[model samples]
Target chain A: MIDTIAKLNGIIQILALVLILIRAFLVVRDLTKSVTGVFFMFAIFTHLSADMYYLIHIAMNKGYYPPFSAMDLAALGTYLLFGAAAHSLFPERTGERSETIVSVCAALFAAANVFLWGYYSGAWFQDIFSGITFIYLLVTSSQAVYRTGALKRDKWYILGSIWLTFVAGQVCVPILQNAGAVLAANAVEWLNYSLMFGTFLWLAAKVILCARRTEKDQALALSFGLMCWSLCTLYMCAEPFYQLALFGETFQLLLMWFIIERRVKTA
Target chain B: MIYSENIFICIVIPLLLSLLFIRREGFRFVLGLVIGMLVCLLSAYISAFTGTVSEMGHEQVAVYISPVVEEIMKILPVLFVLFIFDPPSDRVFLFAVAVGVGFATFENCCYLLSVGSQSITYMLIRGLAVGVMHIVSILFATIGLMQMREFKAMSLPAAFGAVIVSITYHALYNLLVSEPGITSVIGYLLPGVTAVLLFLVNLRLRIRVKT
Candidate 1:
């Protein structure tokens, strides 16, 4: 039964990769207007690279690791890919020297990760790269949302990307090392996977909703709802320390959603 | 000694005063306290969970953990006010400040409870610094929201710009405080200066609103 479950998990991951690849291909073809389509393609690349890295790590433990592993290459590739996607999505505005500086800072951070840590420590390198990339995405997406005046559902896109990159890039991998029990690590892993997948689902939904009804208020509500759901879930699962994180996120989500909805309805 | 009880006094007294003195604005008052407490509890919880439940240690709290958690917590009330009342009054800036004060007051209480009369001087410095910083950051975010409301084109960038600014300010503050020597004192003083500047900006915005 355990074997079956493991196999099932593997298959699901594989299927997700395939879906991601198809999306990437479609995006490359320039056939989809959906912003999420582009994001999903990149997400898939990151997701696949991460999964492959773990698979290789596991194989090494079993004394069957392959030389010239795809995982390492994928890790490097995804890091650069994220930077490229972010640059393309939110190109520098004319006369915005500050943004350009920030973008350059992001690139330098990514490069540092690859040069300093990529060769010697796969896990550490990936974490650092992913962390920088997460911040880059947050800054980039927030810029896109701001520039486009697509405020309604854009919050979800920005928040989703931030959460996914931060959780996967910064927290999950490091925590897995000292997780003590396999169960804890596995749970955290699953949670990480769910967050990434959930982000894709959210971005896709926002795109469709926006395309269907260009109503600004509806878009805002949708974004707020998506953020709220994610925040609420995080709040429920978060254990031990109960400072201001969960409540703050939940309140922000709820407030944004409610305000947007009211504004639209009243208008 | 005075600063030891400041947290409880700051949080509870204001809450009671608002409940009694500002009965007409009861919702705002209560909302302020509730949201303030929530942010404090949540940040502490996240810091604790990542450290204990996740067993990730203090490093995680500093690097991957605190930046995202603290920024988001600080912004929640401001975001809520923006969404709900959409207060058309020029006092939106003041409203934002009120929320910030509420948040800082509660957080001060928490810190006071934990530290317990370490040094009145240190406590005052920390309280004033954190309190002012919170107000300034939220006001920045409020300005973004207000700009977005007025100019449709600026909404997205302004809103996000607000968040980034807040985050940047927060990260810098943390970095300064984390360092030893003169940086901590500078960190403590900087937010107050920033708050005064923010107040001026708010005043200017109010003038524009009137015009």
Candidate 2:
């Protein structure tokens, strides 16, 4: 089972990376003109870089040094670009003052998280940092939803509620684990993952029905698909089951594919 | 941060009492001065607070947090004026400059008060370095806001971009000054150089437009 998961993950990861590179090439060839599209490109690039770093590091060694690896830069950079993308996704132009605020805040937050997490050298520091990121993501996503008036539709609420539930479950996981309720913790985690999967499917459905044939829809669908698969791989993996590397590569390929599709359409 | 009733008595009350002495014509400048000091105070308090919250010590706080806090604090009054009164364009520049200078002066006073230094050389350096740095930083933000105002209305992005410029300048200055020797010398000279360049550019633009 471990070997199978690892193989599956490797295939997905390589495919994703290839797709992202192809999409980047298409973007270079004047495939899409959207600002969000450009941001998506950067986000995908940095995210893939971080994912690739993880894969390479896992393959080479056992222990990880957060600072030495320099993956946090890519991870945090991706988050910042994602924030910018969310803002750009809106049709309406934001006022200069607010944009300045957002840009500064985003920069500060990313810099602080990456460096602080790298330097802190404490157990659970990474998890704590991840929690902070999730909170930040929640805040930014809600702001984007509100600012873009994406909440006018009930789909946002549905996705948001499910996401919130999953996060809440994540928050409770440590407590459950620490209390030695391993089975209960696993049950809650799996339950939350199921909800998250449902939310992703819902989001992808919306993207398909609403954004059909567009690069945005394709990107969204591809991301959701990769994330679902990655989580599944994680579920199947154990201490010796190293599938994260391939899952990461698969992500890269999916984005590259989106880019290529846009190019072909424009061509 | 000796922020107590003593501060209220020494700074706030005296400023309020002095405000009564000024006529309506000079009242705005005085108000700007007092508000600028208050903004500086806020910057100190908030920077310290955030530094503590973020688990930063003195040096880290000074290096990382102070720039963000001080830049934001210095610009608050300008933001208020922009949002509330809708002051005329040229006059708005004057108001911003006043606030900047006032902020710097107050900050200088606080620094001297804390250090109890009487050296004229130190005062001159502090006046030119820290004071002018504050002024220049505020100017960057205000000018950005003003230019954006002229172009497409002061947007959040433009304002945020301005804040970024202001913070970057301030942070760079702080980091440079935190070092000793030549770096500190460069840091001290940097703001004055920037201000001169800015002035020359404005003058040149005015001349070009006149022709």
Candidate 3:
């Protein structure tokens, strides 16, 4: 049974990779006019790099740890693009000053990424860059929520993707290093794989939802996506922190979405 | 001098007083207090479970654990308010602010106790930063809930996204200021920026309501 589970886990990982590739291809194909689509193309590239890194690491001996990894740069670039895309896609719901501030912040992030890659020395620079990026994400996401009075449906997939990626990158990697219990470690690895697969599906769903929607529908879809994603986090991770981070927000997103949908539908 | 006793006086005492002073809607207020405290405890527990102990420093705690824990805890009272009271957006926002005030006052008290007889400048700064950050985060999370109500599918992601953003903001502030430098100055400025954002958002909501 254990062997079978492990085998199933391996199969799931492979399937997830394939799905990610397909989604990437689809995203690229759709990148005709929309800057957001182009941003997603960058995201896909980052996904591919991250997925390939895992595949290679598993296939070969573990070697090299630092800011120099190609995958690391890809991840960093993905975040920068994602931030920029989010700002561009969602115009300021308030005023010109707010818009200017957000644009400048995004611009600064872009400039920082360039400088970090080009001029900055020391591994700590990478850490600082990442830290700043995290903050940037936080501020922009809050602004998006505050302005729109609803979470974007696409953001659900993004949050899931980020949460899963972080779990794989930070938590699973560290635990795998320790190797105290093989069964538990394998279970976590499988969970990570499942999350990745789910994220891809969620992303695809988001695109479809986005394409089909009126403004009201878009809001509704985003809310539903958030609720489902949150519930998934609760069920899949079975960790309190995950619940706090994912589930709590999920409920809030659901509420906002419902309100907007009601208003729109009535109108 | 007040800093040393702030936790008890600010957090515990007010909480206790609310239990006694609140008259007309006694049960509701009590329920809110209970829910708020539970959320805090749960957040602390979740943080520990994730191995994100603050004492272990940033590497072990901030990155992997704190975001998930703190964000979730911040949302609990909002959930409770929705469940128990079924408040409209205005009432929901007020309840959120109340919960934030409770959480912030307590947190400030704890900080004051730890730091001891600090200068008035330090107290004011800490009060504004930490106190308001707590309120802003809760408000943002609540805004997410309000948004979710309007645009259903956006609910979970918006709420989670808000929490994640707030946690990241809090963590970055902590990380940057742990050392004294240009980064620290930026860190100090963050809460001020965050406070201004909160005020603007609140104003927007008020205008929206009036219109």
**Global fold similarity of model 3 (TM-score):** 0.43
> Which model is ahead, 2 or 3, in terms of lDDT?
2
In candidate 3, stretches whose alpha carbon ends up further than 4 angstroms from where it belongs are: A1-267, B1-14, B24-38, B45-49, B52-55, B58-64, B152-155
Please provide, for model 3 over B117-191, each residue's C-alpha lDDT reduced to its tens digit, 9 standing for 90 to 100.
459987886777767766776765565456545434233323444444444445445544545566556656777
- What does DockQ give for each predicted structure? 0.01, 0.02, 0.01
Positional deviation of residue B42's Cα in model 3 after best superposition, in angstroms: 4.5
Give the per-residue Cα lDDT of candidate 2 at B18. Answer: 79
Candidate 1 per-residue C-alpha lDDT over A72-169 given as tens digits, one digit per residue, 9 for 90 to 100? 33333343333233333335474566445434543443344333343334555455644454445434544444444455445645654554454344
Model 2's CAPRI class is incorrect
Point out the worst 10-residue segment of candidate 1 chain A by lDDT: A235-244
Point out the higher-scoring one by lDDT: 1 or 3: 1
- Over 4 Å off, model 2: A1-267, B1-14, B21-25, B208-211
lDDT of 2 by residue, B1-211 (tens): 4443355347657767878898753667667777877777778889889878877678667766787678878888888988899787776777777778777876776777778777999889998899888888888778667755654434454355455556656766776676677767978998998789668645654555577
Worst 10 residues of 3 chain A by lDDT: A24-33
True contacts kept of 1: 0.00
Q: Go through the candidates in order and give each one's C-alpha lDDT.
A: 0.50, 0.57, 0.49
- Give Cα distance to truth, residue A15, candidate 1, Å: 50
Q: What TM-score does the predicted chain A of each candidate obtain versus native chain A?
A: 0.41, 0.61, 0.45
- Candidate 3 on A75-131: residue-level lDDT in tens? 444445444434434544687464445445434433443333333234556656554
Please tell me what DockQ candidate 2 reaches: 0.02
